[model samples]
Target: MALPDPNTSWPPKPWDEAYKVYAESETWRVGDADAIHEFYRGERPAATHRRDGELYEGGVVGWVSSKFWGRPVPPGQNRTRLHVPAPADVASLASASVFSNPPELRFTDKQSKNTIDRLELIGNSDQAHSTFNTMGELKSVFGASVLVSEWDTEIADHVWLSAYGADVALPEFRKGKLVAVTLWTEYRDGNEYYRHLERHAVGAIEHALYLGTADKIGQRIPLQDRDETAYLATLVNENSVILTGIDRLTASYNMNLPTWAWRKKGALANAGRSDFAQLYPLFDALDEAYSSWMRDLKLGAAKAVVPQAFLETLGRGRGASFDIDRELFVGLNTPGNPDGDKIEQVQFEIRTEEHEATTTELWRMIYRTAGLGTRSVDKDTGRQLTATGELLQDDDKEATRGKKILYDKRAIAEQLAVALELDGKLFAGKGGGQFAPPEVRFPDSAQVDPEKQARTIQYLSAAGAISVWQSVKMFNPDWDDTAVGAEVNRILAEKRAAAAMVPDPATFDGGDPTQDPNNPDNQGGNPDGGQ
Candidate 1:
C-alpha cells in the first residue's frame, strides 16, 4: 500500500464503497440536473425505457431516461422539470456559519519571534482564512477533507497548503489521528484516465503516474508520459520518492461531523460523515416536490378544445392556427353538430396550496435533519426569513457551527504546526521557533453588541474590577501582548497630558480680586483664600 502497484485494482477494498459514497455526494454537490439524473438512474436495478409515441427521434427505441429531468413529450409539447440547489445551499450555510469571522490563529512559542513572523507571513500570503472557509464547504459536502502543507521553493518562499476532497484523498489513520494520505489528480485523454498519485508519509512523499481506464488503474507509466505530470519527474527521484526533511506527515484529514465512517472496518475505523449522508432521499424527494409544483402549473395551462372547423387554415402546406387574438373568424358553412360545434375550454386545477404545504414540510424536515433549525424559515408561519434573523434565532444551527469549529481547531493547528516544522527543516534559517501546534480559537457564534461590550469594559475598568491591560484585551481579544501594552501606555500618556494642561488649584484666583495678586481692585491677599 506504500505505492500503487501496476495493473492493480484501484481504490481497493473498503475504498470502493467509500468511493461510491463520495460519488453520490459529489453528484449532489454539483447540483446539476443532468448529472444528478444520470447518477440516480444508474443506481436503479434496471432502467425502464418507454418510447415517446411517434414524436421523439422518429420513435426510435433507446435506453431509459429520467422521469424528472429527461421526461419526454409529444412533438410540440413542453416538458416541465425543476431542480433545487439545496445541497450546495446547505453546505455553504454550514461553511459560512463556521467561518464568517476568521478563527484567531496564534503560535504558543512566544520566544521564537522569527518563527512567529514566518507563520504570520505564511498565513497572510496563503490567505489561510479564506482557504479554510472554502475547505469548510468542501468538507461539509464530502464529510471529510484533507490539508497538505508543502515547502516548494519554486512555487513560493514559504510553505503553502493544498486542499483535497474525500473522493481523491486516501487517508490512513491511527487511533483517529492521520498518519499518512495518498492524494491523486485525474486527467482524461479521450476515454483513458491518467492519474498522478502522490503519497505523503512521515519522512517522504512518493509519486507515481498511472495510465488507467475510467474504472481501473491500468499500469504505472513514466511521469514524463503526460505533459501535466512531467514536472513531478524533475522534483522526485527515479524511485519517485522525495525525502521530506520533517519527521511528520504534511497532510491532515479533517472531518466535518463527529460521526465516524463505521461502514469501513480496520485501522481506518473513524472517518467523518457527510451532512448529506442520510438525507439524499429527502433531497431527492424535495426536488420531486418542487418539480411537481412546476409540473402542475405546466399541466394546468388553459386550453381551448376547438372544433376542427374552428382552426383557421393557413395557405396550403402551412399548419392551421386557433388565433384567439383575432377579432373575427369565418363562419363554418358545414352543418353544426352538438358535440363538435361548441368550443369548450379545458384547464386542470393547480394544487397551489397543497404543493406549497408539501414543500414547506419537506424543507422543515431538511433543516432539522441537516442540524439547521428552521433555517431561513419563520417557524410559526413557515415563511422565508432573513439571514440575520436565522443567526440570531437558530440555536440548532449555532450548536452545529460550534461543534464544527471545535473539530476544525485541532486539525488546523496540527497542520500549521506541520507546516512550521517543514519550513524549519526545508529552509533552515527561515523559521527558528519550536515547531508546535498553536492555540486556535474561532469567533463566538452569537457576537456581543460592540457598543454594549465597550460600555461594559469601560464600567469594569472604572470600578477597578479589571486592569487597563485587561480592559484593552477585552476590547481586542486577538491583540498580542505587545499591542495591548502599547495601547495601555498610550492611554496613560494621554491622561497625563490632559492633567498637565489643567491649571493648578493653588495658582487659581477663583474669580476673586482679593486672591489675585495682579488684581488692582484690592490689596494683595493670601494665595490660599485667606483674605
Candidate 2:
C-alpha cells in the first residue's frame, strides 16, 4: 500500500489545493507556512493525525492561508468546530500543537516531535527528503529540485511532495500552517524509476520578460537571470498589470489565473472539500511567492509559470502515473457511500515486479490498504492502482461484508479484459472482412456463470477474452480461416444447446416402450415386461 509513484511531471499539475493540504497534514508537518495539506474534516477528527482543526459548528469558512482562533460555548451549550477565516472569520480561544500553529519554538514534546520525526524519517528515503543543514541548503535544494523536477518523467502532475526546506511557504506569523507547493511537468523513465520532463525555465523567464517589460512599453527586452524573481516578488502588488502583460506576450486572453482566494477561496474550498474547513493562516501568503527579503535575493519563486493546457491534464500522460496518484488513498481509505462514484474510475497497480506472486501479492496489498490483513477472513486477491495510483474502483470482489466473497461480476470481467489485453487477444477475429478494430483492447463482458463450469470458457470465447489462439493466429498466418470459423460456429451452437436445456425424468425410453411406460404393473406393458 505504499503510494504509487508521483505523477510524471517535475512539479505536480494543477490539483485542488485542498488535496495538497490533506497530503501535508498526512505527513505531520503543522503550522509550516506554504505547506499543502490533506484533510478529512468529519465530526471526530475525520483523520489519523492527533492534532485536529475545530470548525465553526454547522458553518464553514472558505479556503485561505491563515488560521482561526476562537472560544467555545462549553460542553453542552454548543459544539465547537474548526474555525476558518473567510466566511466565518471567528477566533478560537483554545489552541494546541496538533491543530494550531506553534507561536514560538518551545520545549520539544514527544507528541510534537513524533510528527516531525515521522516526516523526517519518511523524507530520508533514497527517493527524496526535505532535511537541510542550513536555510541556504534548504533553499538551494528546494529551488533546484523545483527547477529540475519539472523535467522528471517519473513524477505525477497530480502528486507533489513537501518542501521541508522552504520558508516562503512556511512562515512563523500564521496561526495555522501546512507545507509544499504544487507544480507540473511531464514524465520520463529513470533507469530505475521516473523523473520529470519539461521545457526550459528560461523560456518561461523570457515569456514573463516579454509580457512584463515588453508589452507595457512596446519594446523588446532581454531576460536577466533575476528578472523572473523580480517580477514574481512584485506581481502580487501589480497583479492586473502583470497579468495583462502575460496575456499580451502569450497571445492568449485568459490570464487571471484561478488562484484560490482566502475568504472567497476558503468559501469555495469549504463548499467543495470539507476537510480544509479547519486550521488556517490564510492562503493569501501561500500564493504570494516573494517577500521583500526574498525579492532582493535572486531566488526564483517555487510556483510554476506554465501553459494552461499543461495544468488541465495533470494526472495522465505518457507511461503512467504510479506512486503519486492521489485516488489510491481515497479508494483504500475513505471510499464513502456506494453513490460516491469517486471510486468508479480508480484502477489498481501493485508495487511489486515479481510475476509469480503477482496475483496473490496484489490482493495482499489491496487487503492491507483496506485495513484488512492476513487475520481477516477474506483476503483480497489482486491489488493494483491505476497509472495515477488509486484503488481500482473497489474492483475487489464485491462479496458479502462478513462473508468475504466477490459480489460484482465486473471484477472478474475486468480481470479477463486485462488478461485479454496483455495477451493481445482483443483483436482475435478473422479476415478484416468488415471488422478491423481501431484499438487493440479488451471488452468488458469477460465473465460467465460459475455454475455452468464451462460457462467461463464459452463467455471468454464469445466475448473474446484473451487467449493463446491470438498468438497462434498472428504467428501462423497459413491457418485456415474457413475451418476456424466453422469450428467456432459448431462450438457456439453446442454451447447454446447446453445452455437452453432442461431434463425430464418421465420421458425416458429405458425399457421397451409399452413395457416401461407406466410399468403396467411397474411398466405400461404387463407383468411380462421385466422378463
Which candidate leads the pack in TM-score? 1
Clashes of each: 0, 94
* Residue pairs of candidate 1 with colliding backbone atoms: none
Compose the digit string of candidate 1's lDDT tens values, residues 1-531.
576677778776667777898898888888888898677557644433434545333222233233344333447765555689889888887787787677777866564677877778655444887778788888988888888886668877788766778888888877767778899999999989899999999988998889988778889999999998888899997688998767777888888886555645764455688888778878877888898889888879998887777788897999898888866555565556546566798999999999988888887787778876774555566575665665555567778877877778877888888888777776778784346688887776534447657877977978989998999888897799999999999999999999999989998766855555566554554445356
Candidate 2: segments with Cα more than 4 A from true spot: 1-23, 26-492, 496-531
Query: Residue 516 in candidate 1 has what lDDT?
Result: 57
Candidate 1 weakest ten by summed lDDT? 55-64
User: Model 1: runs farther than 4 Å from truth?
Assistant: 46-79, 124-126, 260-264, 315-319, 333-344, 379-393, 427-429, 446-531
Residue range 88-165, candidate 2, lDDT tens digits: 111111101011211111112233343333223322333222211121122221211111111111433111123222
